[model samples]
Target: MKSVYPILILALVLLSACNPKSTKQEIALGDTIQTASGLKYIYLKKGDGRKIETGCKVGAYLSLKVKDQVVWNTNKLPDSLFTYLADYSRLIKGFTEVSMLLREGDEVVAILPDSLAYGAKGAGDIIPPHSTLIYDQFKVLKVDAPKKFLSDLLYADVKERSLNAAVATFQKITEGEESENYYTDSEQLNRVWEQLSRDSLYAKAADYAVKFGELAKDDRLKYRNVLSLESMGEYLKAKDHLEILLADDPENKMMQDKMIDLCKKHRMNNK
Candidate 1:
């Protein structure tokens, strides 16, 4: 029995040697690559060599399209890796697999075949089954781990760029308003203000508002600043600021409600 075991093992080794090691195969337009009931990738590069990994962080901008219609697009905006792989188990098997294989600054387009994409079930109301999807991805950046990835403009360098953009956007919107752009309810103006305020860009917010004589002139923008201060845990200052605004604009219902809420929250947190 022992001698027979050696022969059996030898035979199995010979059988395994019959198949070659799996490798990547490149394809061009009008080409089809077959897979073994799973996802496959085709990597393109500007230079020679290839990058392959089991798991890595990729900073990229992606535009997803189904057939001829545009579905989702980040359009050159910087997006981090964690945004896609927050829950590994929940993501489609193909997306998880392909993403894991990507490296930093590596851009490639993927053709996710139906079986590896939505499959028979399909993505409800959007992606359909037996459908081919084209993903134009450009890997603008990469990181070692998900935690190390930067998505929001919270980084010192990124924050600087965002501040500049915010300032520019604010000036452009306020250019047309003589009294106050805030009263105009301009979406562009509101968006720039909201982002600047939400990110605690208080000084930048104040500078832009004060430059055009817009901050002191508009009650709404002043209220936004008050809310910004409150969010930063400057409770007493925020409340005082709100009170001053209320004294001037007593009929402002929004300001009144906000003041009430901020003071209540401040009291509860202190208690």
Candidate 2:
């Protein structure tokens, strides 16, 4: 019986160590900080460079876990880095708070209560509704100056409720840059214009598409311009731009289909 006592004690200790609840308790013991917004974080390694700034581009490696089980890891990402234009409104609240506090070489573990995370709706299949998220690791690798393009500034400005600033920034882009790569690619420009349209800045969005067509001398921008004009209910202007685009790429089946649709809409509007 004396020998069995020691063996039983050892078995109990082993079971406690293997229990998943222990892992959460261990993490909770780390130095913690709470924000007014209810976000809680623990600094595993605080960085020692300039702190992150609004509108800065951030590159980070993150691992998301729930209940001590990893749900996602940046290791699967190309180059193992997730680069984004940091806008607090567009990201999880807890993540935005931690990210704004970090600099290059910083690492942190953040616990996001449901309110600061996906909340009641949760994320898609991987995260359950009302689940608290554990960002087990976030390693900040780079914090870069804001991109030169005004379109890149729009979301942050809008989040800050500085719609006038966003308009001013877009105006600067319209002024044109000396660099030939001022407009990086057609796809990126199109996305920015789409965001503007969503924000109800349809006239500015259409103007950007038209101005980019002139600046880049790329007919594709005219196609985008037509779409923007259509969104604004300027069917006559849209049809005119569409005709210009069709003249440039008569064999483009997508443009041909758009032309057919626009003509039908235009005829209906005239009646």
Candidate 3:
């Protein structure tokens, strides 16, 4: 996927360079050696060889600048690489390359050309076309691998989990009816998916909630699951969850009023 940051912010690249290990073949580019893919990567430093897996708890402290101008950067972003959902596909090519090379407590400054940086589109208007972007990435810390179910729960993998969860949810929503006959609120469904992306647990829980919503016949369980999906910024999902709960309990004026206020505050449709 392209950078998720707004156009003005400098999205990171995947790992495209590594330590000075000799390969069977080598090529050259301007001031850098080349690979068959036309990737001219420079290894600024070596990592400690600590492997980072998807869905692991990792944090990055870094400075980013485009040319001489500063774009957007986080002093330290506590990223939950823990879930398999947090994979290279969702990251930039250069970032993925570098991440593989890094271990716990590693750091490097990677210089990226527009081709490997943000490509022709660049990062919105902040990064110019064919411009170079620089990132000083540091693996400030990492949590121990998941020792329990929660870690496994947050682990991201390119599997059929999402599809299965969605199907299961649809089945429950339709009872004995076929999936083709279901009345799905697509906009609401998308909002739920987007909410999942904000953080790890919520993402996993949302998936579970969708699956549960599909399979569940009890109103009580759905209501409780919505509470489980709550997070710092998952107001949209919360409201949507509440709406589902409201469908089963129209007389619960307190929840109805709370949903109304949350919708108004979030500027989302109450429906």
Which candidate gets the maximum lDDT versus the true structure?
2
Of 1 and 3, the candidate ranking higher by TM-score: 3
Clashes of 2: 0
Q: What C-alpha root-mean-square deviation, in Å, does candidate 1 show against the real structure?
A: 14.5
Stretch of 10 with least lDDT, candidate 1: 148-157
Q: Model 2 off-target regions past 4 Å? A: 1-29, 88-90, 145-149, 152-195, 217-224, 234-271
Q: Rate the local accuracy (lDDT) of all candidates.
A: 0.56, 0.74, 0.51
**Tens-place lDDT digits, model 3, residues 143-207:** 33422222122123202355464554554545654433322333234334434544445546555
Query: Top TM-score: which candidate number?
Result: 2
lDDT of 2 by residue, 96-210 (tens): 8778877887888888898988999989999999989988888888887644444466545544555566556555665657333233445445566678778877777777667
Off by over 4 Å in 1: 1-35, 38-40, 46-55, 76-82, 86-89, 138-140, 146-271
Residue 160's lDDT in candidate 2: 50
| Residue 50 C-alpha lDDT in model 3 | 46
Worst 10 residues of 2 by lDDT: 178-187
The C-alpha TM-scores of every prediction are 0.36, 0.60, 0.41
Q: Indicate whether candidate 1 or candidate 3 has the larger lDDT.
A: 1
Clashes of 3: 27
